[model samples]
Target: MRIRSDGLAARSFDAETVVLDLEKSQYLTLNETGSLLYELLRQERTMDELVDAVVAEYNVDRVIAMRDVEAFVGSLREHGLLTGSDVLA
Candidate 1:
């Protein structure tokens, strides 16, 4: 899915990503890998694409990449950072 831009703002610095959820008055800081995934989500990505990106970027095992990607996406969902019906698809 895509990032919700309505009341959210995001910035990247070095290998980190910072997201400001103006509607919620909350903010989140993401590490390097999280930043990569977040940037990808700016467009639209399926779960497999996310996992593959992690694997290609870090040379991690597919299983590990899948796990990490899921956790990252779940965290984004928990924080209400994602939009569109395909977010969890």
Candidate 2:
């Protein structure tokens, strides 16, 4: 799977919270954990890497992290914020 970083630029609202702003659109709010995941995605980490990172960083099981990451990616696609040539292939 492909991760899109074009729409997001990292910014800190406070010491604890991180926000992702979509291109010319409103900001997407993320908690500390979500922010960490988002930053990883910015580096174009593969699906497996993201799952591993999430599982390592959070106290969640591998299975749950995989499912949650898939769902989060799907949501990003649905929002028109994510685009990739491979997406249609």
Q: For residues 1-89, could you state the per-residue lDDT of candidate 1 as single tens digits?
A: 76776898888999998999999999999999999998898897888888889999999999999888889888888999887654444
lDDT of 1 at 55: 95
Q: For each candidate, what is the lDDT?
A: 0.87, 0.64
Q: Which ten residues in a row have the lowest lDDT in candidate 2?
A: 80-89
Best by TM-score: 1
Off by over 4 Å in 1: 85-89
- Clashing residue pairs in candidate 1 are none
- In candidate 2 the C-alpha lDDT for residue 71 amounts to 76
* Candidate 2 TM-score versus the reference: 0.68
TM-score to true structure, per model: 0.91, 0.68
